[model samples]
Target chain A: MTNDNNDLATLALRDVAELVEEKLIKLLPKAVDLEQQVIDAMEYALLAGGKRVRPFLVMESSRICGVGESSALRVAAAVECAHTYSLIHDDLPCMDDDDMRRGQPSVHKKFDEATAVLAGDALLTLAFEILADEQTHANPRVRCELITALAKALGANGMVGGQMFDLLAENQDLDKIRITRLQRMKTGALIVFSGESGAILGMAEERRCQALRGYAHDVGLAFQIVDDLLDEEGDSDDLGKTAGKDSKAGKATFVSLAGVDAARTKAFMLTDQAIQHLDIFGDNAENLRNLAKFIINRAN
Target chain B: MTNDNNDLATLALRDVAELVEEKLIKLLPKAVDLEQQVIDAMEYALLAGGKRVRPFLVMESSRICGVGESSALRVAAAVECAHTYSLIHDDLPCMDDDDMRRGQPSVHKKFDEATAVLAGDALLTLAFEILADEQTHANPRVRCELITALAKALGANGMVGGQMFDLLAENQDLDKIRITRLQRMKTGALIVFSGESGAILGMAEERRCQALRGYAHDVGLAFQIVDDLLDEEGDSDDLGKTAGKDSKAGKATFVSLAGVDAARTKAFMLTDQAIQHLDIFGDNAENLRNLAKFIINRAN
Candidate 1:
């Protein structure tokens, strides 16, 4: 992509991030009483700030598929909620045990551990509620499709399964194949769902759905590769998280297997392949193509 | 209800319980591997015997509303999954912190705390996946409705919210109204969903739905009252849990507010009212009326 195209993509990303933030603020429970600390904690974690990459993918994919914007925005918010819930749980003392998230105290650190657990649970339940509501989609079929896709992506065979595998991978000899499978389940599943949500919402052709799936598959891996690289080289202040923790913990990562320079080259290759899968959509998919590049290039 | 009617309900409950257990066994992930300890923990926690009250409510409600047995069974299993997930999380060290459940060590005790947390998360995700699948109901409308109802019942304003209140109520003097609200959100919410699920599945008339809701409201409170009674007087051998723990912890409960005799009388009164609400269905609701009586009369 050219510099102008990059600028356009950057502007579009910012707009979508703002839109998602606005929708989420409206959707989240908001009362400032101490009695409802769980809701307060949930809102705190959700509104705390990220790149909104998943929501961007959902909205952009929906735009390319000609789906309605309002419905797509709701789905985007739901996806972000689920994503945030995962981050909260993953940072619990019993899990990855991180005290900081996005350069701020994690949910458990900000509130109590019990409140953190309940907040994560509430956010997850709210995501399903949002998708199941009739306002999200006029067609009940579409709603069920979204719920089913999300449940699968987040279930034992997907995100949870990946997390379990990751815990077990500690001090274990994980080869490239094992590590790839782990990343696919842990991180790739939701990314795939984000990409395919538009196809499901629009009831797109099988070929179009297949194209999105291919694009998501490569982009998801590339995203993980970039993440591994970032963890290795990025500063904690810039990344907004603890840096080099994976290496410190002796965990197997893409960068560990391929080295940082090789992993960077591999991420670029995957990004290029991901963009190629969007050629069928032409100019309608320009944002998605740019997103593929952005994933590999993002600083945080 | 007569002794014969009570016997008939007992037999039906046993049949439904067995069916639900069988379905859950098949539905749960199975593979005995070291790395799959999380799945094992979930299955272990789920299969531990209880009265299967929620599943029975679902099956009975569906039967009266003219829904299919197969789809209702799926919903019943899903309800149990959600219920079991709650129990697992409630028993976690950060929550209720109970070491024993159903006469066995809790999930966190049997496995590690991390495994228990992940298992609970997986089961919760699986419940939505089961409901959203086409096999649960041919109509996507029905699927969406089920998903929506379950999510509402389990979210912040429902189970999680109630839990937060319960935690806050510790060492505090909670009056009748506040305690009632807490129990309604905590336990009553899901029971209401179980009863109304049949109406949703059968697409019953608004009046019938309202009737079921009323029945659920009274029965749910009565059930909790009996629980408080059991906690005060029942034996650990029979209850499969520590008895008298509520008073020991100084947590306010129905019995704590009303005394044993008054609490027991209130339970009977609520059960009578619960039966009255089901009068619209006449003979079709015999099992439900009997179940209401059985809930108060149960030893455990």
Candidate 2:
């Protein structure tokens, strides 16, 4: 058996993922006769292999903030759908030009570019559709807030905005502040959204919600820094596609600004800062604290 | 001055459009300078000049339903934003491939394709964001319902789905039934959403909402049919773009399916049906009724 210490966190994460996954499968409407093709594409993208890190954050924050599992599951699925849409668009030829994802051909590579685009667009719209279902319609005010938060996280000021900045930053020697801001918007915003959404939906105290946002912001930056580090040192086989591709693509990353060692140190500092934000919750935030450590030290 | 009969409808529409335009122009937060860029693209598409028909429908419907003009303006802007996003995306290189819009270069033709795509995506997200602003936070349930309605109108089951069908039907013979379904989803959904959303937001009677939906549906189909006839007969200079491009692209169209005379007749019939739906509301729906008549006889 695995060591109980790490296993406990792993077990909790797995349980959350399993529960969210089951809820999603149940919530998704199966195609009856003619719309099977569209349904199939949706299922393929959604069910494809990936660690359920975002959903875990959603559920963990909700639980810690005293929200029930059912309500949090809707928020979890909504974020996952948004993330999946980003992945679909990012893999397009005009975008990242990626042909592989998660050890399989990307959506466009497996199907076609048009289909992939539509699938991504459909998933993005469906996220809000699912959240507005009759089951969650009871909390109408909170539901609208969640929709607004998710849209802001996904829109120009959030992920798409960050992407535009990243695109403009290509091949340029960028400063540390600009690079951090870019990553914070592109990668960190959604992560913050994932955790903060849970807090908002759970009706957590305003101060606690603010604390969660702070925690997520620091963790997200540190997480991306670690990802940059891994891309420098990890093997393509382990990464499922590439390593050092960022540098080759003239992309700006933390390692490009500072040496690998310095980037690593900065990453650790961010992680420590992230953990410090959890001090208010004390031992109740053990999973979040441990998750940050795991993210920083992740191998594959 | 314009004829008194025409003056009231024209002046009221112009008043509503100007009000919504001013509000939207001021809504983007100045804290993020990048937001200005987003607001610029959105305004470029929205304010460029197209009659502001969709916004007029929203505002007029809201007034008929006893909804306040302030709340109506927000939904009007939201509907226009959604419509503008569709136009931007439809003009992209991978989609309709048009080069001109409202007598100017298309969003993609003017800006880069990637920028246009992001702009369209941003505008779509902004619609929800604007609705959820603290200003309108008073009616969260109404906001949530409108957001869900707009999402559905734009998703695969609606405009995007209809576009997919059109793309696949190119150079292929599609039956009149299939063509009707395509136009209904692609064009009808949003118009229906525009008319129905006002009533939904105003808490109008369910029967009145249904009547508005029915009226909007017929009018939407009539608008498409009229557009088809114009494409076949309109001058490029007068229409602000090259006419007959639909036939050049070998795309399926109502004129191609039923011929020009039949198409015109059908448009008139649809308009009549739409006006009939408004009879239940009588003079209160005069603006909507006049709007339907105007749609069938539009010059561009």
Candidate 3:
């Protein structure tokens, strides 16, 4: 039964990933006469292989909320574009300065630093354009809600703010609460937005939205904890990134503050809690439930 | 009579600027505990004084098209935020590397480079949020139109692409056509959006929109040409920025490609052409006509 569930989750994730990728490919602007390089850079950064977890969250949440596939896919693509833009900027020389992303050269490394910056800016702009387009949803109110949620999540008080904290927190002693806050802002906010987007799209009741929010909160933390755990133990090749970066930088992570065993136990507990929040959706949220487990248990 | 027109233009510009500034102050996110610095950097960059020409264009265009002041002011603030974000990013070390803007240290210089990047990101994100808000317009379609216009203006094919071209065109032999195209993308796109936004808000006829487009097109180029002229001849103190950097970098500008006298002549011609497009609106477009002349004649 457990094996069957794992297979089902993997298949579902793969299916959504393919659909989202197709939509993203169609949505990205084609290379024009003089602006080819920037477009190429954008495509390169976005097309680099990842698990597409954020888009999956958007699609699965939308499906459970009874939104149409076209609207869901557009939002999913926008979420992915925003996520890719963040990664591109985060890898810049003044930021993390990582040369590799998803086992390939980072956008800044592949193109020039200036190109990387412009490409990132373009991608960020494109995300809002996608959300604002009429095809995203029949209801303009729904579109506006998606835009507001995304802006709030990605703004200074959320993802960018979290990044600022991460930069300052380097070499500083931080407790679990501070770390959690940092992670929540840096990684969890977008996840919450992705999940909540479905509720907005389907015009779900407030209780339904709150339950998804709760689920997103726990799942996002668990995902971050697992990231920390993987950084501590996973090989660079398997991770497709420079592993152990946190320990090398002396950054305070969950695994660094708590022992590996404690951190793993905590992630498992959070996964369980995240699943509990889906009780309101019952059988309709099976994929989400499996996703919570998959997030903590993934090898990379 | 000319002096009287100038005075009226100056007073009108000031009024719009003040309105936009007040709205911007209220619209920017308040500093939270840890993310206070990023918010500070965003405020610092945005509040740095300029002539506020883009917002003025938004306001004046909206007024001419019969849009309400409140909705127009919100969009005006949004335009300023987006423009400010571009300026902040343009000043980064990997980009233009300017240390000063509006007679003060640039955002990256005042803060750190990472903060500058994140603050710029936040501000850009905030621009969309403001446009997406219900306060921007009663009609969701209008809000979406504003967002789409801003996004396209600031996207890869627009401002970012123009910047990319500018970076690549440095020290390269380029003709007036290429230079104009680059300038249109770099600077003219946003100006066009600012003007066109009013028509979108008012739901004006296509012919009215086209008139604003023509005005924006000519005004935008004239604005860039005058910018080049100032960079060539104006004092750094008066300009509130380092002047002559384009010539110093061996950049091909209208002043460089065409001599100063010819470039000045072209600016005058463009301003006249821009005014000619406004004839359709008659007395309602008087402010816009004056604004066109001001674009060419401003000392700073």
Candidate order (DockQ): 3, 1, 2
Model 2 accuracy (lDDT, Cα):
0.78
What i-RMS does every model get? 2.0, 3.0, 1.1
Give the worst 10-residue stretch by lDDT in candidate 2 chain B.
B29-38
Top candidate (DockQ):
3
- In model 2, the Cα lDDT at residue A151 comes to 83
**Pairs of residues clashing in candidate 1:** none
Residue B295 of candidate 2: its Cα lDDT? 72
lDDT of 1 by residue, A1-300 (tens): 457767777888899989999999888864322338888888899988888888988998898899989989999999999999999999999999999999899999999888988888889999999999999889999899899889888877788888888887887888898898889889999999999999988889999998998899899999998888888988899778899998888899989988888888889999999999999999899889888877776633
* TM-scores of the candidates in the order shown: 0.96, 0.93, 0.96
- For all the predictions, what are the DockQ values? 0.62, 0.46, 0.77
Clashes of 3: 0
- What TM-score does chain B alone reach in each candidate, compared with the true chain B? 0.96, 0.93, 0.97
lDDT of 2 by residue, A27-136 (tens): 55444222344445666778776777888888888878887777888889877888888888777777777888888888888877766776777778878877765465
Q: Please provide, for model 1 over B116-162, each residue's C-alpha lDDT reduced to its tens digit, 9 standing for 90 to 100.
A: 88888989998999999889889999999999899988988888888
Better candidate number, 2 or 3, judged by TM-score: 3
Residue A15 in candidate 3, Cα distance off native in Å: 2.2
**Chain A agreement with the truth for model 1, given as TM-score:** 0.96
